[model samples]
Target: MSPNGIISISILALQLWHCAADLCNWTGSGFGADGDSRTVLQVRLRCTEGSVRWVYPGQALRVVLEPNLSYAQRTTVCIKPSRTFRGASVYIERAGELELLMTDGGRPEQVFCFRADGPQRPAIYLQASPQSDVSRPMVGFRYELLGNRSAAPNLGHSGLQTSCRPCNDTELLMAICNSDFVVRGYIKNVSHDPERQSSLVEVSGGRVYWQRSGVFEQEEGTVGASRSVSSWHGHIHTLLQCHVKPGGGEFLFTGSEHFGEAWLGCAPRYKDFLSVYQTARAARRNSCDFPLD
Candidate 1:
């Protein structure tokens, strides 16, 4: 069911089984979901097998297991909204060990836990109550299980547990040219955004090398919203968490003024191609206008 108390119109079932191609290892094979609304709910798995799948609202599912197999298998799943749309987050109100009645014969399966641990490993959690003023509350589940090492020895990983990805070169260039100012600075403060969907970070002790709108103090820092955690000032220079990429952590950054407010974007490092961005800056300065060169 969705957190808003809307009942799901259908359910989905995913089954794990022993694969003859690989011994002592379980393979995820079966998947079934009801309904046609692919936009309602989304699913993504890490270190496990499954493409991003959309689900119906308030959905339920029955999970079947092989009785003789050992209970050790590594699996992590993230249920959230489709990334193609505007930024949104899932709010889980309840989760943990669950007993399910199998559909094959309506037999009950033993409870298992899929909770993730450690900062590197993100797990879904149930808040006592809903957060205030969040626009993108989704119905999703997150779990991380480290199966018995001897049984499931080959759990490989590909993508990050979180949704953030590095920015491309064109995005970096566009961000540099369109901002009020671009600075290289360290993060001095960290707080939650007003909406509670992301973190607000302030950067200080950096120099603003470029400005388009007007004059600004070199000491004055700017803030950005991010979805990832930022390192403390001086310890690690990182991007201010902001809307362009909801989660903020250590990454190359470029800040621009939007609607008279400071906004930043995750960008590629200018140092990587020092001559390129430097040349672009010089061209802009000479012409007193934005130059593609």
Candidate 2:
């Protein structure tokens, strides 16, 4: 034990023979016959994105992220705790030191990110808290390893300050090309959650050009004169401070999706996007070809 009475458990070097075949997710229980409260379970994941589900968490679990990335590449690790997360305090282990990331019993609605490209790779450590009841809450989180820090969405605290900034022409061009989902839509509604410090923007998409995930779904609705029209509907999350309001005319929504949830990025007026696209196309400067509506 250290002078502070906190036990410093080192990550075990044992082989991970029980790794899941998917190599991106791991699901297991912490209850073992050994009954050693100090036992630390080791899990290794080698994917850009994945998840971990720990049922009946015990002493601790160390998740080592060894994604297939080059040594010279700078990667950022972002983890979104499950909404039902409980009974465990999460930490980031860096160079034998533990830094608390999330406390037990707290609902983590926001995603946490950190740089994990140093010589000593960072790992996630989950330590179970003492329990008095018979409740066996499951604790887990989904993780994503982002290689391009500049292109990645601003999810960290520092990035929150600039979350409301309007995207410039160059940023908008790149956002449309690299974002997970791109669509032409208008804001149907904006709901704010003060507790989570976020706002969900409900969008009625007229056209979906591309999407890396199933974030938007087609919905049939009646227009004027009982005419039925099909439109894509989805929700995009953003910082509450963005002050997003409804009825902003048609916009090109482009953003990334994390853990099955969409986050807002560069959103420009559809007409403005057309002007920019046309100008870029004339100059042969557009990053990718986008079908014009």
lDDT of each: 0.32, 0.78
lDDT of 2 by residue, 1-293 (tens): 24542344454432222334357899988786377665677888878888999999877788988777562364677888888999899887766677777779766656888777568666898888888875779998998876663335765623232368889888988888788888898899999999888899999958999888898999998989889989899999888888888876899998877778888888999999999989999999998898994
Best by TM-score: 2
| Model 1 regions lying over 4 Å from their true place | 1-164, 194-196, 212-216, 220-252, 273-293
- Count of clashes, each model: 18, 0
TM-score of 2: 0.84
**Which 10 consecutive residues of model 1 have the lowest summed lDDT?**
101-110
Task: Give the candidate number with the greatest lDDT.
Answer: 2
**Candidate 2 — worst ten consecutive residues by lDDT sum?**
12-21
Candidate 2 residue spans exceeding 4 A from truth: 1-22, 69-74, 119-121, 149-151, 157-162, 222-228
Output the lDDT of residue 132, model 1: 48
